[model samples]
Target: MNRPHYILLPVNPYFITFSLACAFLLNLMPWGRLIGVPDFVALVLLFWNVHQPRKVGMGIAFFLGLLMDVHDASLLGEHALAYTLLSYGAITIHRRVLWMPRGVQVFAVAPLLVVAQLVPFVTRLLMGAAFPGWGYLVHGFVEAALWPLACTLLLMPQRRPANPDDTRPI
Candidate 1:
């Protein structure tokens, strides 16, 4: 299908942007110790990578990760590399993942979340941050826990095209 049809298909770009924004806000929220949640950007980017690969891809993930790196004031390019790999990973498995049930999808995502966290952790370690300790792994767990919630919130009517038949945007 053409690009316009893709835009008008089942996912709206506006909603996608909003969803990512919300995830970003949530990530930015002051949660103290509870902030150990996995990377929200990874979750949202993976979802869109599978559901709407053409719209959300590695570039967005990289840019967002860079922004997050700046916000977190951590090593440069650490999260960027992680997100870039994550985006590619999601795209690689998008088709297979789409065919799985919701529960199975959740199971599938757990590892991705784990690996996503591991990548940055290892990167930081390489950059001379000392071992971040197991506490760092907690974010992966929290991220897994939050996946369903993220999916539920982002998988809203606003994100999906209003009309299934109107495959071309007005």
Candidate 2:
């Protein structure tokens, strides 16, 4: 018996930047009235951090988080701190997380997202900002829940045809 072999296509750096830009724009979109809108930029950054740690690491996450702070007019360095920690966590587990199946990967990443969210929330609290209540955590959960979908969409461009001769049974 022969099993189909699939090869992953190389991803362009420009495509990754473009996707991150799109996620930033999505985050900027007005959804103030909504209760639990996910953080698109953080989600994208985390995804890239896990899949391409060499290309997307702490510096990019910090820069992007700073940009997000300016976009949202939030406390300076709040998002930067969170995103930096998030990137660190992702990079630390990049190999292990990549080894897991997609479904398990989602769960594995949830705590990282939560920690990312917690950083900003804690920063705000220390700065005299009022607690936003448990509702604030919903966004992290939403981001985690959408992980599978985001991975599928982002990887679509990287799917390539397998070599005909490479198909072999184990």
Candidate 3:
């Protein structure tokens, strides 16, 4: 079976900002501080970084990181550092990942997502915080699992149906 290729329309800057804002807001929701809640901002950020690197660069990631830092009230630069690295890694391999099947792409990015989560874990550990449990790391993979849905929803506005034969944008 062949993967469907999309000829996406130019993404609107406003839409990007709006989506980021929505993701941030989602992260703000109180889920009893659940470990499995997923870092929604990171998910959306990586998506935009991979799909629209030029528009959503590291600076945006850094800024969002700062916002998350303030919200989380953890180490000041923890999220900034993690998000920066995540953005860098995504931008680095975006070309290859984009060409990959979604399932394969999940495996490719899972490590990156784990590392992104690990940065803050190590940071807290360095500051004398105790282990947050392995579930913390598992959250990264949980976030990574959302990749396919994120790609579909995020790309929806930009995607145009190529043909009747193709049911969804691969």
Give the per-residue lDDT of model 3 (tens digit) for 59-105.
99899999999998988999999999999999999999998899899
The superposed Cα distance between candidate 2 and the true structure at residue 117, in angstroms, equals 0.9
Candidate models: Cα lDDT each:
0.77, 0.88, 0.90
lDDT of 2 by residue, 1-170 (tens): 25453467778899999999999999888886155788898899999999899999999999999998897789999999999999999999999987777789989999999888888888889999888887887888889999999999998888744443566532
Best by lDDT: 3
Across 1-170, the per-residue lDDT of candidate 1 in tens digits comes to 23232232366688889888887887786774354666777788888887888999899999988988887888878888888888888888989886676667877777777888889888888878878687887776777677777667766664465655656644
Ranking by TM-score: 3, 2, 1
Q: How many clashing pairs per prediction, in order?
A: 1, 0, 0
Which candidate, 2 or 3, has the higher TM-score? 3
Native-to-model Cα distance after best TM-score fit, residue 17 in candidate 2, in Å: 0.5
Q: After best superposition, candidate 3 residue 51: deviation in angstroms?
A: 0.7
Q: Which ten residues in a row are the worst by lDDT in model 1?
A: 1-10
Please tell me which model should have the higher lDDT, number 2 or number 3: 3
On TM-score, the candidate that comes out on top is 3
TM-scores, one per candidate: 0.81, 0.90, 0.91
In candidate 3 the C-alpha lDDT for residue 164 amounts to 39
Judged by whole-model lDDT over C-alpha atoms, candidate 2 comes out at 0.88
